[model samples]
Target chain A: MSGADVLLLALGAVAVGAGALVVTTRHLVRAGLHLVVCLGAIAGLYLVLGAELVAWVQVLIYVGAVVILLLFAVMLTRAPIGPADDLDRAAWPAALVGAGSGLGLAALFVSAYGWRAVEVAEPGTAGLMGDRIFGSWVLPFEVVSVLLLAALIGAIVVSRPDIGAKDAKERAR
Target chain B: MIRPVVPFVVAALLFGLGVYGVLRRRNAVLVLMAVELMLNAVNIVLVTADTTVRAAVRDAGLTHTGGVFALFVVVIAAAEVGVGLAVILQLYRLRDTVVVDDLDLDAEPEGAR
Candidate 1:
């Protein structure tokens, strides 16, 4: 057990804790902040693992781009930032039971496969990762770009007032 | 002395807490946060694997797929945030609310069920 590992474990704990709070809370704004904390932790874990490229990606993509986009959308909608919104319903028992099973299943999977040790290679930097991503997974990588484009288009269509008018035109009797 | 196990345990615990939050919270935004938490927990494991696994059988000089997988996850997370927020925005416009409890596609309107 090295000092690096211990620090990571503790960071992981804090990250998880903050993330859970993000979900459980009723305030959407707070939820976004918590997500930042969670993503930050993941970045830390990436650094600890010696996957520096991945660590930076986590921060750049998640913290920098994704969360910022989320905040923008939230602000665009002008979501009531106060604690007025109801976070959950009265189905606490069912929710608890479902979540418990999810944890149980994950634990079972870990126990089943965890005992077997897999070989690990040394970690590399951004240059190595770039070669691999651009080399090995180029096809799926390009396809995902198209997919994201489609989603962006879909979002625009769904939210634009013109779409609403078009829907009304179709529905007009 | 205690290294791998602590981080691993912490990751698992984070995953558990994330699941609990997702199941319990009706807020869509919060649900997304929980999902992110779970993803982070997985990344922890991926990182641990990268650092800890024996160096011989692993190929490409990186033990775990941490770098590769994390990179993809980042891309996917971007797309997810984009699409998810768009949907949420549309829903808010229609219903004037962001509460997940208020959303129901199965209620079956005349045009779209």
Candidate 2:
């Protein structure tokens, strides 16, 4: 009914649609591109929901970094650029589960809050989010930074086989 | 005033689609992409919950927890992707294939024994 509500619905539709394409597309590279669109649309949904900081962060991280990483992986793995026939497994079970959960969850939500309107919160700006992150969330924030550092080191070690080969050989001996 | 159910439904459906993709995709990278979809759906739910529960949380002096959690999820997802890709690339190096079905979890490498 309201402008924000309308925007939310439209963006949600775009996101879901693009997400479908990201999954079902035959071309491997195109799936990555579709993921970018899907993520961008979700970012728009975040904006409409008044999460300005999260929305921008979604764009910067998901659309910008994650998708690029996926694309690079796809290329590095030498996925076929054209349509691949064996990209999908059997569909019946997947379709059944997908539709079951999707529709079932939708039904549950609708039944729980059918036509119930709630007041939107104040838009979350960067400053407010920053205060919360650096204030109460500072500990967890540092932990996450540590996690990132570990992941970085782990990635480097995993990718480069020579890093620990000597140690593994010594241990084996 | 937007209905909370709308976004909730969207997120649920997205998660379901993610489940399907994870099950259906043969490629390792595509499976990872599906996992990303599921994570995004969770983020949407978190942000929407922030709006719906803002009043109650503001009274408790803890506003924006959901949004902050969502941000943390983003950070975690980035890390997961980094490490996941490294593992996948290593698998590709070892086997020259990235198909999930081609991977045999129980089988030992030819020279390891």
Task: Please give the TM-score of chain B in predicted model 1.
Answer: 0.80
Worst 10-residue stretch by lDDT in candidate 1 chain B? B56-65
Candidate 1 CAPRI classification by DockQ: acceptable
Per-residue lDDT of A68-144 in model 1, one digit per residue for the tens? 87777667777677884467766577456645754675576567455343332455577777777777777877887
Residues B31-109 of candidate 2 have per-residue lDDT tens digits of 9999999999999999988988886664534788888999999999999999999999988888788999988978765
DockQ of 1: 0.42
DockQ scores of all models, one per candidate? 0.42, 0.75
Listed per candidate, the RMSD to the true structure in angstroms reads 3.9, 1.7
True contacts kept of 2: 0.81
CA lDDT, candidate 2, residue A45: 88
Q: How much does candidate 1 score in TM-score?
A: 0.81
- Per-residue lDDT of candidate 2, residues A68-103 (tens digit): 999999999999989999999999999999889888
